[model samples]
Target: MNYFQIWGIGFILTLSLSLSAQQVPDTGYVAHWNHPPYAMGEGPVVGVDGAHNNFHKLNAGFRAFGNVAEAGGFRVVSVDESFTEESLSDLDILVIANPLHASNLGNWQLPCPSAFTAFEIKAVDRWVKNGGRLILIADHMPFGGAAYDLGMNFGIEWENGFASIESGGFGDLFTDHFAPFTNADSINSIRTFTGSAMSSNRADVYPIIILSEGTLNLPTIAWNFDSLNTAKPLAGYYQGCWTRAEKGIVVCLGEAAGLTSQLVGPEEYPVGISTPRVGGNLGFIQDMLISLAPENDDFMEALGWLRYREKTTKVGDIPFRFQVIDWQRQPDGHIMLSGEIIGSAVSFEENEEDYFVVEVGPMESDDPNYDDRFSRWRQVSEFTFSREPIVYPD
Candidate 1:
């Protein structure tokens, strides 16, 4: 991911910012959320509409970034207001709720305009490459607004197909729950959570949420929102899992159809169920929004990187790194991140050399009691020289 001037800032920010008096950083948003009740779903989780999402959740999240963080806080502004070179310079993070295909996320190496435009790819490249945190919410099978445009940065996409749920109420298309790849039966000593009816090619990842049961199957076909290919939606989530690929962390969907759902609005909400709380759509919206709040370390960073739209190879420790890796930006905007690590360095001659080879696919989200380290490097790179991240193609 490249980060030149996301949201139009005028400086480069890093983890080095002071811990006591952080200022607010310029942040941008992409408009994609558009479901009736507007993409709402919740069973056991607790969420409150208009509470934190705008008034409730956001204020708290920002308080930590702005008032709490030493260097700066996250301030959401209009896209036009924030889109600029200088703003990008000072931008600490960018959140793309559900981006669609655009001139951004492009490829210029092709003889003609690539399937994607260079601008389309480069915007994301510059943002992440420059250490900007990105958060992306992707749609699975049914295309939940604009999710894939940002999802691709991490090598993930909604399967764009159908979905099914067994032993649960609602249609077979409505699923009860979903699982991760690592939680399934072991094959050849490695757990392969693919082709289990719900998901395919699942990898171990920090899953945000999975279908519990009674979830709808996505649209009946797969189509690029940008291209409007309408190729036919694929199968959807059904207690499924998938493997993340590429160099960045990924969150994948079962099928385009699985992500399809109805959103709950103020008029649509029902109150007085949980005493002071509302019931039905309103309650459901609140709970789901809370889940979407990203209640862990640096929610902004995690979400930003997940939706990164560039073409670079980046890997890092979950809570450790809050920004994207540095990479060269392509002329047309698309970035090229390829090259094996330089092996056999003169610095560490012993077994610490294998750290350069640390690579992994998507993470599994189904297991409640799973090891985070298991989804990443098989062996942690214990470099005698910790300061060096040997760069290739230098």
Candidate 2:
């Protein structure tokens, strides 16, 4: 018998297997943000997608997600229409969770098609490139298959299989690989229940939850597994990752339960953020949302000197440092950066790519030819710098 036919018989014999583990949003779950970044309803606009026949919606399965985001000061809204330029124009961030195709709604077998159309995928791609953040959460099996096309646009290869610990049991664990993105001194290892796996080789991609060794990817009919099915190791694959898309950022998660609180089974066993094993998930979620938000002007004003190493080794690689000591917002809403370097006045102009570009010469402002000897202008991305000076050995 073929794989599906074999599993189909097993599935029919235990029809209640999948139905018994039904998960619903944990209504009593509460998210606490000690210091909210913005006042209520004053932060970036976040759209939680309810279209595309999603299994998780803002008011239902993903209620804790919206609660956490709102507690962190983001303005959350529901998106009921398909993605289009007009639909995405006003939103600063979009969140999609566990979307399923119409055909795969009740049947989690094969033949899963893309949840999004080619035109919608292109529109979202263009929107992100022009500065729109996206948070995509695709769970196991049909969920991953549904988001395959949209995930591909952002360099993610979704594995549409159930990932579990090869040694047996659910709850795969992971440690943080990239800490700078979250600025956390040390993050506790987080746990994930039966989810999917994904991989990306892009240089810009940063891993948050990397699957460990002994984890196996089982490609089976959902909730039906047997010894006859072949297993593939998913070591080194990512369960959660983030990357920059031109001017915007994209966070792709292989699972959705870990980010939200839910209760499974007839007895209402807690899973996801509600469980004690994943307590660190709330902090991680808050950090990620704060990082993804647009830069705050008050926070930027407190920044110190930004250091940049010269591409050429002409001056023994002594790094150049610039600080925006003062700034003013013009009537047209453009910010002008002005500062002094070694007693010489300097100003920065915004480039077409939104980077700050500036030119400078010798440190001495008394030199008459200083203006004539200006060095080449360079583009610098937004980065926080230390207040202490950088010392290089002679």
Candidate 3:
């Protein structure tokens, strides 16, 4: 790998030396993380807590996802401190953890309930309607892997509240004996969801994780319920997540635990991008972030990005070498702009093609460009081609 392509390096460096050291990942969205416990390391001297078993900012190793620590990169922050109506504008995407509440525990360990205010629900609904991409990861416990809260917001519901993975076992909840699900979601299986609300948010909203079919549902909170009384999950549970809303959109996992990460060997499972060691769960989270914070039409995708699985680009293609102009940072930090594909300037007869000449055009905001033949329209000269792959550059 070239020096820049190294996983953790790029995130800690800045594009122009004149800029402050605080800015990293100069190319894409500077990540804003509110991940509690797992992703929380910054600066040079950060510590690791084995209890949580999360990727330390610096040590998670780019082999899977790039190290988030270098850029002040991915981090853990309090939701209230990191988000506001105004701050919402800064985010390109949002991923709310869908950890299960508690099917096993007799009563929830703490707190009476996890309720949302009317305003909070409205803000989230509004965000997706206006083109925000979202990903939800599941956890089992108080919620029993149903991840019902997030599913509720997205007009979906996961019924498998507490599964006894081993054929038939009650694995007591309320007690510490219950273990968390760590298997990564399967991207291949996830993309099959055909919900319009899911697709409208982004033409490319596909799944990175796939959960088991026919999940069980516990309508209420954690604790053992009458086995005979538990409800079967219904597909239409997501009926009103959105419609007539501005950016009206929603996508949901039938089971939250599908996004859980498992550290098993390649013999047992596979990741989306063909990264044997990394889990699809990691790719699922990274994919959500990339979707939310797209910097240009040429946004990056993870190892096994499913949407572009069939598309191919050669090194010398002009469209791949195309430049982006008119890209402006909106007051809310969202970007708006246009793009064009530049064709080759080769002149076989004259052999004088300093600049490739193709008639490019009919371009406007979000407008598709199609030339009569192999045409090259005018484009801004603010872009540079990659001579080689980019490594880490924080």
- TM-score: which is higher, 1 or 2? 2
Model 3's TM-score against the true structure: 0.39
For all candidates in order, the CA lDDT equals: 0.26, 0.63, 0.29
Alpha-carbon deviation at 378 in model 3, angstroms: 20
Q: In what order do the candidates fall by TM-score, top score first?
A: 2, 3, 1
Taking the tens digit of each residue's C-alpha lDDT, what string does model 1 give over 161-216?
22223221122221222222111111111111111113333354334323333323
- RMSD (Cα, Å) for all candidates, in order, is 19.7, 13.0, 15.2
Q: Which portions of model 2 miss their true places by more than 4 Å?
A: 1-20, 167-176, 227-230, 296-394
- Estimate TM-scores for all models: 0.32, 0.69, 0.39
Off by over 4 Å in 1: 1-73, 81-88, 100-118, 139-146, 161-204, 212-394
Candidate topping lDDT: 2
Name the candidate, 2 or 3, with the larger TM-score value. Answer: 2
Q: Which segments of candidate 3 are over 4 A away from where they belong?
A: 1-76, 81-84, 87-89, 98-106, 109-114, 141-150, 163-228, 231-280, 296-394
TM-score of 2: 0.69
- lDDT of candidate 2 over 1-394, digit per residue (tens): 0000110011001011132268778867889987787888899998999999998888888889899989877999999999999999989989999888899978886768889999999989998989898999998787889988899899998888766655333443433243234423223434455667788988657675666654554555665665215567767777777776767778888777767888888888777777754535677678667767766321221221122222122213342333334344344433344333321122223211212333222223665544221121122324322333332221
Q: Which has the greatest TM-score?
A: 2
lDDT over C-alpha atoms for residue 68 of model 1: 16
